[model samples]
Target chain A: MKQWFLGIGLITVFFSQTVQAEIVFVTLEKDNALAIVDPIAGKLLKTIDIGQRPRGIILSPDYKYLYIATSDDDTVKIFDAETFVEVGQLPSGEDPETFALNPKGDRLYISNEDDNLVTVIDIPNKTEIAQIKVGVEPEGIAVSTDNKWVISASETTNMIHWIDVATNKIVDNTLVDPRPRAANFTADNEQLWVTSEIAGTLMILDVKTRQITKKIRLDIPGVSADKIQPVGVVIDKQRRWGYVAIGPANRVAVINAQTLELEKFLLVGQRVWNLAFSADQKRLYTTNGRSNDISIIDLENHKVTKSIGVGRFPWGIVSKP
Target chain B: MISRFFMNRFLLKIILVLLLGHTALTYAESIQVIKIAYITQEKKIPAALSNLDAFVQQKGLIGAEIAIVDNNTTGQFTQQSYELKKIIVPVSADVVEIFKQQVGEDISLIVSNLPRTQLMSLVNLDLAKEMLFFDATTTDDELRNKQCQDNILHMLPSRAMRADALAQYMMKKSWNKWFLVMGMMPADQAYAKAIKRAAKRFGIKIVAEKQWTHTYDARRTAQSDVPVFTQGVDYDVLVVADEQGLFGEYFEYRSWIPRPVVGTQGLVPTSWHRTHEQWGAVQIQNRFKAKVGRWMGEQDYGAYLAVRAIGEAAVRTKSRQMKMIKDYLLGSDFALQGYKGNPLSFRAWNGQLRQPVLLAAARSLVAVAPVEGFLHPKTELDTLGFDQSESACNNLNKETLPVKPLLKGTYDSENANSYQQIIQQIINKIKQNF
Candidate 1:
């Protein structure tokens, strides 16, 4: 009952400075809810009970719907963005940890971390499209901006499986660093960026050949090698810089996208997991699972400006204009 | 009590495909099918803690079946397939002769769940020259020490590894002083020796040692008798060495000082447990149950690791030859995930796989060990088992190569800004108790 009153009190405090506010969506892994915050207001607006063990969260291209991988529930729970109503579920194969939405937002690609398969679900019809087999313990799924290629990075196999989007068939495999965690293509769909957790490095690949072009080794001045686990990878829309969430090192590595060199590490909260660019591409938000907060970074200056405490184990994060 | 057996071989021809089997047809790619043989000598099931022997489902070979399904799902993308052939030798048959005749040139990979004597002789046979063996059942330290062979890899944690894992956790919990209870069986004696080795290695002191010689049924009078059995020199925890489920289960709650019981039973250290659900372990647990319709046992998990490790090696090297796969697995590059937080790898000094042992009770996971502060220069996993410097095998050369730090950066040991492990423990305790 005390927590219930605290939730309502936070909502009213968030209502005072709602001017020019952009809403941010954060999935609370331990609280089993979705926390909505007004980044401009620097306060949590409200939180809705989402689902069980919600982790991977994303908004559709048009920002009409929200998809969350409610892992324990074994379904990707979809919510209507505006109304916050439970819409339906995508047939996420068991233990869906991470997923990707195509640029068209009509197709959703989800990695079944248990089944070692990628499940594709059509958005409009709300039906299963296909289940494409990948590698063992597959995670960090992404579809190219062109929607022509979808890559699944298998942590154990350490290979990125390239699937032709049209046929939903794996066409090729590229060997990578040990325990590859996440992969993404450039905004132009020309270069592929990948993060290796154990190797503590970010790999960039040429899309034409699917071969590694540069392997940027991350080095924090005083941090131990084992503590520098790199996980999520994100680059701004302009392709000016790239940031990799260095897990446990509690920092986001800034890399000059052009030269592909490690610039510096921006310190954040403890166990910083995933990263998301603001809708305007001017700021970045990081989810620190251990700290139960999201650190806001002013991308213009590469500085951690503020941190807002959210629900327990605050995991996946995204933003709306 | 050897009974005449009739069944000779069980073959599983799994050609799994999804969605009308059209994925395979559309790809029109060459699928490489790798054959693996599971050879085991038939043995009697040991007594369990519970009295429902009839209710427990047989789970020896089911773990390999689950692995085949998992391997095939990944193989669908890599154009590689896996097929398993099982042969459980009965008392009436000659195990070596059957293995030499049946598992021919076609199948070079084999996983065995056999006794120490049988496994020792089996891996030493001339027929084992070309093939690689995966020992999934036996935990005898001799196989990892004196009887170690190049062709065979021990997938299960050796008795020493389990003891070390427990000692690490006990040290982490500040349960440094221990009262030891030894059981009657030979295996129990071997376990007791391993526990002593662990205590000395981890700086833990044993305060008292006693022999469990009572043979009467004490289940009903556990509360009355356990206190007397556990009484002697004040200790932080009672560590039992009952390997055959004799009387260790009764010590958890009924100890003389209301202390926690640990070791082979009670809060035991294991490679896998049903109650372990962290680090995506729930995925494999649920998948195993969904397929086998039963709980995955410890031995079952060992077999699962064997099959999946081979699959990982094969797919990574893209080869079916035993030489390539063996070299890749023993090499420093091999990292197989056993659903533990860290990637599982093989120890260079011995073939035992280095993994974090799960410390669990009957219904909950207590902690994962190679605990937080037990530091090793190479990898934290090496701290769990016999390191390269402590290896006793003559056949294996002790390679003490230091891993090149990924970056030339090092934080001050005392002031690292990392995930606070103490906070994690508090969080885990809250979740566990609630």
Candidate 2:
């Protein structure tokens, strides 16, 4: 009996460690700092500042480094995830707003807003591999799970350019709502969701068919009109729930992922920009620019659990493990 | 213990089956029906209804239903057909308050084809909270200017936009000195005032001003006419503003004027004309004549476009919800398959629908205005109304608004550039130009 109880205790310890793994790095918007946050306690442990206006952050699948698109300085800053220190910086196209890293971490797709071009960066050597011309004012970018296609939203054209990842050429361009600011693929990889800020609506396009399947209108009064802009969007792995950040309203709209029904507004700080979830999926964090704080929401209750002090003008958020 | 576990599993299976069945039943609920209230004159009801009916049928939208309310007849169109609910109250009556009282939660949208004063009454009610109002008539600039409302979607072009188009064309010809001749009527005076405002903006100097009055007396034509006085002024253009058709046609080839005449007569600016053949106008004109069984007029096109805008919004959003449709219409890249060049979109600053103004000579389309160089901060198309930086509305956030610096140069110089070069230069020059 003693031996059996000891074995059970060992298993419990292993399970808890796996569930509560520490966050390896946290990317900052202002100083381009990658702070090593103590994930278990949710505290900022250390900070390493890099390039200018660092945004659109993501971690390599291998958990080696974090890549951030520094828009103002026109470079992509790479930092070692373990040490939270700047490893290298890659030159990107002009006014790089958002980017996507290839599944193998071999190539980076960056959307250049001012230049109307998508720059492909080769990862190992930190060099630009190719530059493909796209429509006017390309802002948001998302890569396919299979690494076959990279889609970027062109704001002025009101369309999404689907580029062939291998050839670095535009394969297809599909019309979407006006001023499509952000885009993300569903977990099942069947549908692409785009948010049009001026249109004040969310457009869902079928990935395989390349056709708009549905356009869901947000009902929040002040948030659905002139300046009521809808910006960031994220879908859960199970495709059960989706969340979108309403820029002017300063709140995140919780939506039923399957039905596309707007559930309710989860109030955050001023000028809510982008959102990301913790690895355990228990907490959701949003970068509120005006408040200069990160709003932490308890996902289960759909309420603001805490507002953590972060860098000035926090614009983008990404979780690292 | 094994049997108990199996029983629990069986119970869970039963509950899951029942839940799925209930969900399917809920999904089978009927689609929401959209109710539209259409208010117009008795004479115009039959034509409007038939056109709308045919359009709805062609579009395959089976859910929308319209209720016509005619104000001219004693009994409304509502009484004649079961689908209609009520008639629009008479103009002399308290129609504004009546509409407010009668507009229930069931009404999704209101289509009004009424006079200017009547339309203004409806606009004053602020019915945007309950229903969306589509104004098919009323060319009053105030409706689109100081009296502009969030809920009101204008179908007709304002007087200022039309006058500005003509003024722009005149400016292109370097016709700076204008002989302004206006009638005694209120609309004529207002139109003349609008013309003078445009002349000032486009650098056209009003060299002389004259007024004509309609009279029943024998010596009226000789006495009321300003031809003798106008001939003495040194002017490059003659502008006549006559609403009652009093002195409009007489000003065309009068002995006094050696230059081109514009405004209400010789070269007038309008929304649509029969001879407009460029940029897919021929197709629209042909289709409209075929559908309506008559030559297309400005009012007819305006009415048709209002409905078409709604249809386009519905098709794009894939829903009939008023709020969604409204947002979609106001969004950038909203192209209307009509007379306007490229696609028509709402100006983000003033909420005015940006469109190419048509200048008509007699019954033929002559030119499109803003005549090139009359530039706004953001777009050349924005030169029609108030610029964003100059707008007096305090509700908007000035920080996010684009500050377009005024483009300088005479209209003649602007008309020199090729179309492609202008488009290319516009795209390149703008900081965020699309």
Candidate 3:
């Protein structure tokens, strides 16, 4: 029985790392276009122009479709991943800024900034099922690994609203910093790390208690507190390291998860926003909006290995095999 | 008869000797020693002084002499102008008295970076006749407005100009519905007001305005508190005027409405950033980082431009004289060479330095100002700050201020310039000024 338990634990760890390493990056450019880049090659393979300000993009769990929220068009455009062709478009809540895909890829939770609502869409049917009202400026959407809960960060309210996936009802809302822009759960789904861009700090919340267990502050004075702005966050499943994008600073901060201490700062390109890692966890790519390029960092070296020029105003990156 | 003859010859010789001595004295007086006094409390001032000294030495200006007095010292150095003395006071007046006392009546020019009040005192000095004051710092509009002095030449960009450039850009985006978020501090209020004025001038509407008491409001982060402020709001963009490090960053992702964020957190207009490599930004960034051992900020870029402006003016006029430099700077064709694009000139209506503003999305350069479509009745440059036709300044000193022909045709008066044009103009101005 002891041998069996040990074998199961080892297999879980191995599979988690494997899944984390083989991720895909779906980036949005300033011109309302999407560029899919392969992490291993450090090259952009396809560029899909979606109409009228495309942002907050996510891929289906099966890696078949890519869904993008177009703010100006007020629709979510779907593309066939392999062929890099548009499949269809569905109406999302107005001004959908960011979103999260369900574990099984059956639903997409979108944070619509203009309407103060979180819209749920059926991935297969390509239709909006329900719209749950939340705090003002809903952004930073994420789904729990178990697919039981959906979380949306309301920037104006400084709160995180948790929704029960099955019932589509508000479960709990917890206060955070001035502007909670991004959030992601730990591998085990025990904790969630949310980035408060305005506060220049990261809030770690207990998944069960829904209370902030730790507030990690960034220390880089001389730059304005506004410049220390934190945006997208990604955590390794083992919870050993957390990578955060400091927007104004245009750098990625690698934090030791256990100690919450900032370990290293890797300089990327201008307006560095989001990240997507390779399947092997050997490479990380960030979209730099201002520089109009993608910064690729070698995870092992913890430095920018190369920068690949992409479309205008690149934001939000995702990687997949 | 022999004694009388010897006495007469001796007297003649003595007279000759006296005449030679008088000639030598006249020659010595002709070679004037231009004495300059430098006053500052900061130790770094001396280091900067050394750089200037090297330049002067290289130029073989042997007749010039510099004397530095630490302003932190007691009144030991206090004195009014003595004969033939020139005083250069750092942004402080405590040392002004010392310069006056040490070099009475001989002061030619007063070089200072002092506040308006301190500068006013020196301007009012009875003994400071023919003394031209070169102001390196003071950005108070009042100095150029009500307190306009013939002797004082302002250098830094006024707050109004900065606000106007940013406002014009926002208006261009058709982002008229402003959610004005200001800090509780007085400076923040002033900045916000400037932005408000610009918005109004450009026909942009301020839909909602709120003052955040950031310090004492610990409950700002409370989930219960979120609904109270943002429950119902209709605004296109959030304009933050927080200079005291208040709620600017805290307002991100916290808005009650779902709209693209702008102003302080979302998209910001600044003078310079490290990632700005557009146009000549890379060269400037590299040179500045090499000199300072760090990346350049807006303030650093502004300071560098101010100094470079003086240099550019000197080169244009082919003289180090202040009047000639001032004239060249006011001339339309006078362009600053380094970081800023094109040549920078002063607005005829106000003495504000006309430069372009940059849109920095954090450390990266999002876009250069004077964005694509902004047109002016005069030149595209007018899109950067207050237009000449609408300017309050009449240029009373136009005779002394040289005017060159406009480089580009005036923008269409009937059609409004695009937001991108306005941004580009601001950016061009920054480059020109820098």
Candidate 4:
């Protein structure tokens, strides 16, 4: 096939550059594989067989292991990041879509979307610690840097469940815009940011007061606001910029971190779902689900520099140091 | 249905825990409960058609109850709960007194599944002025036109919308020539009128038109009647107008000419169907089936949408006041996701909820409309229902007519009064083109 030849040609062209770049892991959702990309060379270095419906991919705080949430198998498989071989497995609940790592680096808060529960796993013991019942279709899990609070955003209930990490119980809940998809705490833990996919608004909550400080509507000149579904978000504290992957709009909205103002809508591949920043935060990699490729963006240039073909329906991404 | 009644109570608690956070258990006792009343007439169905009916004895009442459960599931987290006061009045009974006695002064929102005549009578009562009624049953166009009730918000699609939806799908397939068949019923006659209007609007030609005057006879005479009934018509499709299931189903394989049947027959246009399994509809479907033990019908969906609208308004506004909720419902920002792939809103000119109609066959979904290429300046859904610029419903008061423009932020901040006049002229120009 022409596509196969095109991919091989791209790999050869990419191999001529620096070959010992940081590895970027991308979840090939439909292919049941995890692709390792050499970011500096812009080549897919290798792909390891993951389980069925592998969605969320993240590295441990010490970067020793890679944890992948295999939704269909209902288990988080831990792989040795260097050798790319299976090392361990965590007990994830039914249909785990995503998970968050605590700052202490020994706890995993996993979101079981179908079960409507946030399953907490003790990494050292490799056992389920607690199951905190949340709202319907809980998708996003974010843990505060202090490891005091765990927040889970539900898609159907359209609210963020604030769980006290000490008690493993819901301390409070705050209603956001419709179809809340993802939540993240600011690096300083001063504020909490939540994305409402259907409402197309990024809501910021004051951490101390737990009140909505700002609601920023994402709009591109040519793109309809209805199609601008804000799903994945990653904030770079150093650069003072937050990038939001607008689903189906094929663009990442760059926002000024302090002002919460949308600065630019950088067009990427089709149906961009998730994003990741490199160790130096110099480049951003995005998983274009529909286009079946990963777009590498030079953050300094504020444009997509190159696109490397991945597997079918690439969903989540993470970068190695 | 009877066995599931007790099961629903236990299931609802589990659902509440699953849908609401653990806050529901901690703050269970202190939550504020918003009361909603559901009023429907207890009409008898013909014994012949009873077997085919999907609804249990509760029908629309069950849908309202399911929505109340959902509301409470979300309500617990917000320190708000919901209660349903269901009233099923006997046929030919005084609905106004039943409504007044059941609702009293506590409930401000009423979900009505009554007949058109009963609804009209109830809406005329002095007590109805203070309450907002959600019409979930009737598809009568007059309610959105000549008999438009300011307090009544329609959840079900108008007959015109259904016809237009089918017309759009038919137009997409280039099935321009139609053979119109009508059953001898008053509701069928109104549906035929709607179809005719849709045909004219969508540029379809009615090659032949006929009426089904023959009654359903078990004596084998009905079979002889249909072949002759559908003869001599050379049309691409047969559009049947049968509100009640009198004889629409019999025309599928018995027609003289081999053509597709649409409208209320072989491939029908509806607000909801069992086969519409897209855009998270399956979640609601599974929930409804678990509680009601039957496929969710159109009437059930209508009632579900009505209660969900009230729930959405209450949740969004965080207020139980009737005035605030009413303003929010009629305002621009009040959009409800009715599992129709789009956020459904209301038409300001008339109180009709603008939504996409489902074109479905018996076993699967056929299409959803407003179809591709049917463009609207504002929303594609506006192309299906009566648009504000072209509707005959001029019931909106002139003073408050500018409310929509103000809500949409389309009016010029400077020269507000002059812009109202200019907007009127622009609307009139749009009417001429339609």
Candidate 5:
């Protein structure tokens, strides 16, 4: 009777896992469009005209609205998550490339790359509340889950700035490797993962003290060291794996989160830029900017199951349940 | 007793506010001032084949100015400030007095827009011992090699780096046969020598080599004359060494075999160009255009890097001393963002800034080198210029104590025209002897 029960449970879990994710949205930089795909069915549902140079994409906490950073337009466009219709706009300062939305979904911090300022916006009011001055060429930005500190990683300055959420001022700074491309905070808010594109290394900083806990040198056999540029970084909430998209190397480094070590390299599309995880975290989606597609990684088996062609130069991705 | 105690408390509060205000004022005044000197000789730029190309009278100085603005912006946050002192002299002027003048004023950092001869003169000046000089203009390889000084750091890529960059792109395309065309200018001859060196290093064959002897303006006549000039060689590409904008532009679409041209013209290899828009370069390019009403050229970009490097080193080390700044810059920890897809650092063997050279056409960037498959154990950038083993310059990492004490001096900018007469006589005598 127990064997029979286990067999039935296996079938149920398989089907449930198949339907874990509903849809995935990818922003195309060159084509200026958003590709909607059904990850379970592995189908490109449709594509809609997005905006000029759509790069950074995020969803509201409730998943009712979609926020896209149209970099060339110098504004972040808001859309109805279900209808895929433009709803509003946020006043992102000049040349917004990447941004972070607070866990509360009330405040949004935009990285004004050229201006070297993090412009904060009240999402509901669609108004600029504060613009915190940071380092030069600030790109990577992340707000802690508790919404206490917002971290801005400056590319040229090689420094990470800690912005207090309550005050919207830079409270502290930590020096990192050259050309830090992205930053990701763990769900528990204990660790922060930063990627250095030029150094080809991933730095894990202790969030409490802002001290770099570990530095993982990203490398792949047969791939030139210069091509192992670490860009987008994401960590599993289960603390199993931390995946970093190695740009131009065309591989996602699957790091062992528990051991805090590099485990394996999962081959992906060309110029793999950003990554997004499904709501249930069953699958991972990576936008390959050069290949113009998204590589879907089945997290359970640590395999790239499929590569779905998107629009031209897919730069950003976000998956929905 | 209560009234007296309240009066004393009010007085104390007033005094406390005044003390706090005084400290703030003093802090503002005490911000570290990093003074820099920009020296450029006003040399005559060769007239372009057409009016399409721009010629800036103030080439590297504008870039330094823009960088000063950039430095001051970062300074506001770092609690530091920057000052630029420019000294523009005529092409024939002796720079010794100005060099002494700059060093006397405690300007330990200097940006040089001078050519090799003028730059070497400054490098040899007795007062230049304790100062750091950034060569922003010249691409002379000799400065990074045989003539290298411990204090001189080059912002411009050597001619060898540019040639190697172009050669790499050509190698990638399988265009191995290069036809070499030489010009008479000393700069052009130096460029050709570097090209020959690159061809040998990369194992590419030079199908034929010819010197550009046509002296007349080829603007209108290039249509008929270029085909004849380029007729014989069945080469994959024409590599011209016209640094003075001579006949290099005429080879485009005018080649006998319809081959493409590369080198100083056509698809040129450069440190920075107006058309380069990758690796977050567009941000700086846009900012430059907004500040100065023209596209930033190679020397301008070089000058910009020089000032920014000083600013960066100052912020990193938090020191105003020249020796400390120089040590930090040459150390392993110094990495600068040059918007070239790599973190630039100076080579300890040669004071040259190791960078990726851009192969660009008129409209867009073709590719960046050291291209794929070119490997170096230390860094791929070492593939471009003189490697540590190949370079003769070794004083970069060693301590260079001040050779002579600086003396205060006042300057006369004029009366240096006779200096050229002496060099002219020497050249004439050498020509007669040869």
Candidate 6:
């Protein structure tokens, strides 16, 4: 096992230089809409009509088109980034709850929860390249930077299947925690962080060894441990700081990447679900499902500066320049 | 001035180190074995229903064992070893004396799976004053209201909670009329009374009520006598309460009119069912099946929850003292995860557990109750059971029923409006229930 040594003495601090103009897109699962927000002004611009049960949102690498997985309709709807108009749609598998884009941005890997398969689609042709079988109720999908592997987290099986992209086959399955919701790769692509919503813990796996290096337990002193469920994770590459959205605790935990220590927890709205970072990485936006709003966190100041109301049940978020 | 600043900072660091050391030493000294006991009657399978009940042999004891294993997992981290002693008394044995002998002085927490009278006897003892008894089996509402004890905390949903859960869903569907039919047993009659209370509470009408007086064998005469007995009822749904599994299952398709059966029959309200597979329940179900060689039943889940509650309390409070744990268990901060979609907590008013009751069919879950519009000030789960505002148990200790602390500071108009709306909803619910 690879042990992470805490670089406590040599902490490097970075300051936000200038505010970047960015538009934040949030998927409202129940409303079947996406609200566009101006992060710099901390205001919601408008909600655009979308398909049924829209959950995961992402942009192509070139920022030309946006892709959204509409779970109820079982389709990935594509919209023009500049025009904000519906461009086309791709046939996603049954109940496509979440998905991830490859590094080169030509393929999309989506989790079909009902079918227990990951449907890989070719972006240009909008055709499924393969459907690889996995554990039951797969919800989270993450692609490696080098595009050599894709990891899918199964909620029922309580395991993460590492799929070889070249062969479209599960190479190894590693069990982590109960009810894993999402997975993300570190900046250097050497570590994988998977969040377990039910266990309320984050397991960091060493990519090379395929072994969990650390299990970070998020327990706020005064809050109930059962309510502090870790969901979405975003790590800053410049400062090696990780931010985790704790579900019902309504707070974000900041972890020092070097030490893997929970440094601080900043309170936000009720039942915070997912998170996104602005273009310049100076601001972080969190979707609060119960409060029907989004909280803006000033990363440099480590404070929630504002909360802007949006549609009902705001689910996931993404930011594009 | 620079030398003095450095020397003062060094002294402050030394002082902080000394305080930390002192705190660690105190924690180490305070750590002790958290002893728990499971007191219950041996497995009693009725001869009539032995072949029909799949989980007759493996019930409460296996669930308690699973919970002990789960508690020890967390206990290892807190430097507390959890020790459990199982005391199973036979049908002819004296339960009170055996429970007392097994629970000797050291055990401060207990999980009990006794019937109503035996449980009352256990709680009336002087030895129970310092112990926390988790009632894991009985669903009798009287234990929660009329004869409630401060030392006993309920782990299972009460009779009213289950009835209210079914009524809420029925109301959501706008099924306004019900026909009630119950067996001759006392348990069936008690459940029928609970359903009638739910009908009054939810603004629904009980179109007709009757008792099943047939002593004919269910297997021999279910098809012959059920249709004739259920003939002449003009109702939207039929609610049957046959607790001993006599003829409730036969009324689904054998009813004179082809209506749905709800209460204890076709669509049943329960805590844990074999068909429930949501909210990470499949993991626990699989785990229990692997360990016990059968599906987990309602009593088993209750026992599992009892042991887990003790472990969770110990780990969170970082102490094994019974007083601290007892206080925290009833406080606003105690929330346990029982594979439901949300956190399950005990009500301060009656010690009844607040949980989402599942309306399940035999093969799949139909829906969960305390449906969309049934609201509460604190949580939606409060709508299912007896709320604190109008409960019968008023003599509970004030310290145990601490007023829930508000999360945010001063409320704005939006917050105030939502609070008012919640109050109005609760008032309407109370009026309907009464």
What are the C-alpha RMSDs, in order, of all predicted structures? 15.2, 24.2, 27.3, 13.7, 12.0, 18.5
Pairs that collide in candidate 5 are: none
Interface Cα RMSD in Å, per prediction: 2.8, 18.4, 22.5, 2.5, 2.0, 8.9
What residue pairs clash in candidate 2, if any at all?
Answer: B377-B404
Model 3, C-alpha of B14: deviation from truth (Å): 99
Kindly report which residue pairs in candidate 1 clash with one another.
A222-B410, A222-B411
What's model 4's lDDT at B312?
Answer: 78
Chain A superposition TM-score per model: 0.94, 0.88, 0.89, 0.93, 0.94, 0.92
Give all candidates' CA lDDT scores: 0.82, 0.66, 0.63, 0.82, 0.85, 0.81
lDDT of 5 by residue, A1-321 (tens): 999999999988886676554889999999899999888878788999988999999999999999999999999999999999999898999978899999989999999987889999998898999998887789999999988889999887778899999998888787788789999999889999999988789999999899788999997888877688899999999778899999899999999998998889999999999999999898899999888899999999999999999879999899878
Which candidate should be chosen as best, given lDDT against the real structure? 5
Report how large a share of the reference interface contacts model 1 reproduces: 0.31
Model 6's interface RMSD: 8.9
Residue range A1-321, candidate 1, lDDT tens digits: 999999999887776545345789999999999999878767887899988999999999988899999999999998998888999988888878899998888899999887788999998898888998787789899999888999999875678999999999988888788778888888988899999887778999999998888998786876655577888899877788999999889999999988888888899998999999888888899999999999999999999999999989999999987
- Which consecutive 10 residues in model 6 chain A have the weakest lDDT in total? A10-19
Where does candidate 1 stray beyond 4 Å?
A1-19, A71-78, A87-97, A155-157, A198-200, A216-228, B1-31, B52-60, B219-221, B397-434
Clashes of each: 2, 1, 80, 0, 0, 2
lDDT of 4 by residue, A37-149 (tens): 88887888888788998999889888889999998898999999999899889999887889999997899999976567899999999999899888766887899988888
Looking at model 3, residue A154 earns an lDDT score of 69
Q: Model 6, retained fraction of real contacts?
A: 0.00
The CAPRI classification for model 2 reads as incorrect
Q: Write the per-residue lDDT of candidate 5 for residues B1-434, one digit (tens) a residue.
A: 99987886676557555654554355445576789999987777766776776777898888899888777766766667899999998767677776665556468799998887878888887777878999998888888888789889999899999999988889999999999998988888999999999999999999899988886487555888788888977989999999978678888998888899999999999999988987779988988898788898999999999998888787776666787678777877677878887778888778899999999999988998999989899889999978888997877774423222111121111112222454466456645865
Off by over 4 Å in 3: A1-25, B1-434
Decide which is better by DockQ, 2 or 6: 6
* Model 5, residue A134: C-alpha shift (Å): 1.2
Query: Chain A TM-score for model 1, please?
Result: 0.94
- Candidate 4 lDDT over B73-173, as tens digits, reads 67878667888888889877788788778778767888899889889888888888888889998899888888897888898999999999999999999
Mark the regions of model 5 whose C-alpha exceeds 4 Å error after superposition. Answer: A1-21, B1-30, B90-94, B398-434
